[model samples]
Target: MLNDLPIRKIIHVDMDAFYASVAQLDNPELRGKAIAVGGGGARGVISAASYEARKFGVKSAMSGRLAIKLCPELIFVKTNFDRYNEISKKVRHIFHDYTDLVEPLSLDEAYLDVTANKKGNPSASLLAQEIRNRISTEVGLTASAGISINKFIAKVASDYNKPNGQKTVNPEEVLQFLEDLDIRKFYGVGKVTAEKMYQKGIFTGQDLKGKSLEYLEDHFGKSGSYYYHVVRGIHNSDVKPNRIRKSLAAERTFSENLSSEIFMLEKLDHITEEVVKRLKKSKVSGKTITLKIKYSDFTLQTRSKTLPYFVSEKSIILETAKDLLFQEKMSNSVRLLGISLSNLNTETSKIKVLEAKEKAVSVQLKFEF
Candidate 1:
């Protein structure tokens, strides 16, 4: 199984503070100043903060009031997703110039398989440098990249030197690198998992590798096998492109918690419009409509209904979402509302299955070494 894994050249590209940087670029006077791109209200949460704001411990998902208190001079700018999406498109275009196997994790990050690239480049490191330079020159923003033999290591390496930097891990150095890595820094290990690992005497990759496969599986369940192989540098996940998106959602947190069901119905009307517009843009629709609500106390409730056929019409989605909302009893005053569509069209479903099959077959193919 280890011999079956192919050594593909993968590059992970991540934009540095994308929204905040874009805000700075568009407003020259905001450059070098502590700024956050989010709402400036008592109930508002921050979406992104510039590096300058980091000095004062400002961070994303932080309450606007606390962020302001941390950085007294912090400038708050509203999010401009349309503008950010435009820039993201340009960055993706640059990526396709080198390889077709580009998997975008978000508007700001992607994984690219460049082992057999259109550029005929021999070094993934050089390719990363060129890509970063192009982004800086053309988009007026900086990007960081990491190059390695697989997606897992590459994604982790991308953050080694951020905000316009790159790192390359040669195949020979892969194992030693993993052995020295801290468990807390592992790609998928969240805070809770890391705490559990520390309690188990698993502090680094070497410590994780010391455990037997059966022991790992018994302790961590299905995720046990993942940690076992990753610690040994055996991740074989592909950099897949054109994968069908499972769902499309649009949501908003209100400045004030609303008590009236009538007001929620009105809000759902607008949320449905956003979801429908996004569905049309993606040229896809779903049969499942999910209504998500967050109460003033921060508890969340989701209700979903699946239709016999996919529908992207605004009226259909809005009416269906309204039904889902009213069918469930409100536990408290609502502070957030969202709508999403899933159970996608048949064609997309088939495409996804076929892609998975192809990936599995590719992974099973024997490697040269």
Candidate 2:
């Protein structure tokens, strides 16, 4: 089944602790020290943690106070977006030297399709090493890469080795590699999903592969099919260079919790205006409007309505948001409120769809990269 499919060389490059590393790069005093970027205040949340901080169980999204409890000597630095963006551009410039098929997942990571590269390099593994080396030398930051036949496998392989490392899963080894993979390591499986898979006795890719498609679908709904295919090394999604924006959102976290609906309505108007401004700047409209509420306790709730036609006007969006807001009573005092528009006009058909099962092609035994 694997032999007949078309093969492409894909590399997923992820920077190691980007924000914290960047903070260290510019400040020699911060180097080799436990440092976290952002989350310096009473209500602050850590954005990124350095390797030194990570050793003490400090990590991104953990509260600043808790991070301090874990690593008492942890240093907190303010986020510098301009500096991060400047360095990110330098890294991306290096990527373009190899291939134009670069799809940036964030300022710190991207996927590059090097099947047909400008350098004519056949070995994706070597290309990954060269790219990492360049990043280290030119940008002064380390990176980890995963090289494989498809995006899914490549993404997973990149993490096998962390903090300055690379892993290559050759075409022939794809099956065994995935089968041996821990179920929790699959990219899309989060904590809740991993627990669910464990309860179903799916502990590894091999275990997931054993379940029939119907059995998986019955238990896992739409995601069950995804699990069944990915375990079999059947992911055919292309690396899209021009990925479309799926949604646009604007939100505000209040300094103090607002308990009154009237005050919430005033905040929603401002958020709706920001959303409209962004939508107009992007030249896109959306059919769906979603209202997000985050209570003081940090619990989140979202209400969405998909309209028959697209809308980008502030008045229309505000009206829809108000409707969704009033539809549900407040569960608790709200700390945050947001408005988002999805199902945008910019969405189009995918560049390539997953090939049908019956389709067959000649195998490239060499598997160059």
Candidate 3:
């Protein structure tokens, strides 16, 4: 059955602890020590943690205070996005050397389709190694990779041998590999979903495969069909090179909670300005303006207004945000405020032309790499 599907060579490359690794690379003293990037203050959250810190149960998104409680000797470092972006570009340059079909998931990871590569190399496994080698030598960082027949398997396999390692799931190994996989390891299944799956006795891919499509749909809704097909190695989503941005937003977490609407206006004004600047930089506008509010109790609320036409000007965005802010009374003191624009004009005629050209490319069933 798998022999009938078109096979493409896909590789998922992920940097090892990117933010913390970068912090160590620039400062030699940070190497071999447990260091965390960001989350230095009383109200701070960790952005990333070094491997040494991981042993002490410290990780990204963990609160700084909690991280310190876990590892008292842990060091905190500031985030340098500019340096991270600079290094990301260098790594991307290495990817373009092999194929133009690179889709960046983030600064630290990406998906590369090397089915028909510039190198004319038949072995995708070797290509992955070459890319990882270049990143370590040229960029002074370590990376891990997963090479496989599709993006889904490739993504999961990348984490199999982490921290400067690689894994390849050949066409023949795809089925058994997926069957043995734990349900929690499935990309889209989060903690809540995993617990629900556990209740249904769907602990592994094989367990999930035992249920009928209707049963899965009845239990998991739209995601049910996805599980049914993926367990059988039937994921066909393409490695999209030009992923469109769905929305743009700017937000701030205030030092003190504001209890009055009058105090929120000034903060909203600054957020609106930042939103417009980003919209102009991306050369896109949107019809929907959403105001995100987080109360001191940590509950969240969102108020949105979709205009008749797209807007990018600060005056228009700020006015719309002001309207939403006062549309209803404050439930409690606000701790965070955000402004966002969606329904963007990014899907221009150029993207349509590219889609048309993409459809003309041919597919092959036999595995080449």
lDDT of 2 by residue, 1-369 (tens): 777778888899999999999999999999999999987877778999999999999999898999999999999999887799899999999998987677899889999987777676778899999999999999999999999998999999999899899999998899999999999999999999999989989999999999999999999899989988999998988777767899999987776799999999999999998899889877999999999999999999999999999999999999999999999789899998999999999954533212211111222324677
Candidate 1: stretches off by over 4 Å: 1-4, 346-369
For model 3, the superposed segments whose C-alpha errors exceed 4 Å read: 347-368
Using lDDT as the measure, name the better of candidate 1 and candidate 2.
2
lDDT score for candidate 1 against the true structure: 0.87
In candidate 2, stretches whose alpha carbon ends up further than 4 angstroms from where it belongs are: 260-289, 303-331, 343-366
Looking at model 2, residue 325 earns an lDDT score of 92
Worst 10 residues of 3 by lDDT: 356-365
Q: Give the per-residue Cα lDDT of candidate 2 at 6.
A: 80
- What's each prediction's TM-score? 0.92, 0.83, 0.92
**Overall local distance difference test of candidate 3:** 0.90
lDDT score of residue 326 within candidate 3:
91
Q: Cα lDDT of all candidates, in order? A: 0.87, 0.89, 0.90
Clashes of 3: 0
Clash pairs for candidate 3: none
RMSD after Cα superposition, model 2: 4.3
